[model samples]
Target: MGGMNKIDEPTIERARRGDHRAFAAIYHAFAALVFSVALRISRVWHDAEEITQEVFVNLFRKFSQFGFQSSLKTWLYRIAVNTAINARRSHLREDARRLVYEKTAILREAGPDPAARLQAEEEANALLDLLPQEQRVCIVLRTIEGLSYQEIAEVLEININTVRSRLKRGRETLLAWKQGEPK
Candidate 1:
């Protein structure tokens, strides 16, 4: 909602009317945000890319059903978060050895610097991965994406207090984990 003025009612109307250019414009505008959220949640770049594509597909398919009670950003956030959560659940059931192998391959492709920025990003993603998915979603939405509690609540379809609760718990968990880490 911050700078996503590209998804206004007129654009949505054009998309709903089967304007491919309008849909492509919406995808171009929001794809990065959606992909970042998915990658944060999933910790897999390819999976995040797929999730972004799926989100746009679902958005197009469900466009007619949108009631417009919330901002388009809110609706898109809902779809992205839900899709990422589902993908994470399925991913967890996959072979752990394969996941490790893929991660190693990714790290190798990241270059030889042990203290590289990619390592820092990996560490940050690992910390987020330590969070339960429910709390992690709230934390990412609030801290990383800069959504307000009310906006998160609306996007998550939960009470504002629920959003606050999740944020508090998520922060506490990250603090505890950080404290336990070696300096």
Candidate 2:
């Protein structure tokens, strides 16, 4: 809703009232944002695509429940975040199962050390992995997604102070870890 004009009101109303055409238009406008957020959360392209589709399907199913209190963009972001979180949880569970069952079996030959091939960008991203997931998500939303603290609070349904603290802690930890790393 940051830059959205009043022109979107009618489309939002129609979509809320179960108009497929209006909903499709809404989808067109926000699908990329939804997918991008999902991708950033899940860190998996396929999971992001699935989460995006699920978010739209959920929107259509619950559109009537929308009270227009929040912008459609914010609503979509909430859905995307929830979907991505669930998908990530499921993915981790599957990974745990694979690790337990495949511990004794070798599916493929071991590869060389991946760290040896790290590029500058990959090394930068590696710093992100040092933070906990919640802190990482806050940093991603604030810095990478360019959302304000209040905007992140709205989308995340948390207090603004929580967002500020997470960002502060995340930045401090990232810096500390980077400094502790060998050049």
Candidate 3:
């Protein structure tokens, strides 16, 4: 459908019928992305790996419950984020948090001024630093990941309006933090 391995609707339907190949197709399609998101949330690579494995294992175990309410990918991402959050909360590994530098994040293309670029990146990172994990994930999914509000709701298993509220709150927190600083 999309690439060579895109799982078509029919295939997904069959996978819902307990087709092994279809299950594998779903897993292969989403594993890397799930891992990446988990890694970002977890910060520690090993925790991310554990969470990814747990999410997939849960997916396969509960595969039968997957109705066509949302795309399979969205469901899996929800499970991923939830599992990672739960794990982080349970462990309270607050010290392991990582800052996301926008420059290192956007190094794909060359920019005009390296110094100004560095400052912007640092400032963006600093702004993000003030938010909690829930707020950060909402912002990251909405802005950095380009997920629509509905899609984010499905992926986070939140009400669509709740997603909007969190995004708003997160944005407000960021804005206040920014405005509180000197220009």
Candidate 4:
């Protein structure tokens, strides 16, 4: 396959047979690219680091399954994208559950000194949770991650106009929420 010069057949066979050095060589060659993709998609350094590790671990386990029908880079790219997106979705779901718990906890605990900062953060997160996944991701990449419109499009692998439309719809939804209107 194309771009196979970075990894030879011997190394692949060794890695498939559980050679640590062979695996390390593969990791060294692709870790940066994997991490870069993960960071762009997840927008969190910590999550990106975790995703990179998870990808390599997965590669080690599934090394024997490499059929060589495609370049290794392409396969790794697919894995990183899927892993990062799944991790982001999983995190959002966990955040939603945690938000429910925190809301209930706040209601139960009556105190004049409930931190305003924490309340504001929870409100922001709740507002974000109201958005659809696609729009929310675009909004986060644009607003929270400080990515440009073109950058968001590139990272999301979408057309620039699609990125713009998602951001516009997301903003409209947030505005409606602020105005106490039905979304």
Which candidate gets the maximum TM-score versus the true structure? 1
Residue 147, model 2: Cα distance from true site in angstroms: 1.2
Q: Worst 10-residue stretch by lDDT in candidate 2?
A: 98-107
TM-score, one value per model: 0.86, 0.79, 0.71, 0.52
Error of 1 at 76 (Å): 0.6
lDDT of 3 by residue, 59-115 (tens): 878888988787777777789889988876765655444443334544555878777
Tell me which of candidates 2 and 4 scores higher on lDDT. 2
Task: Write the residue-wise lDDT of candidate 2 on 60-131 in tens digits.
Answer: 999999997877777888898888888988987777333211211222326564334334325545666577
The lowest-lDDT stretch of 10 consecutive residues in candidate 4 is 96-105
Work out candidate 2's RMSD over C-alphas. 7.5
Off by over 4 Å in 4: 1-5, 96-183
Backbone clash numbers for all candidates listed:
0, 0, 0, 0
Estimate candidate 3's RMSD in Å: 5.1
lDDT of 1 by residue, 47-146 (tens): 8888999999999998887878987888999999999999988887874433421355456665667457566777777778778889999988998899
| Runs of candidate 3 exceeding 4 Å displacement | 1-6, 93-129, 179-183
Give the Cα-based TM-score of candidate 3 against the true structure: 0.71
Q: lDDT of each structure?
A: 0.83, 0.76, 0.73, 0.74
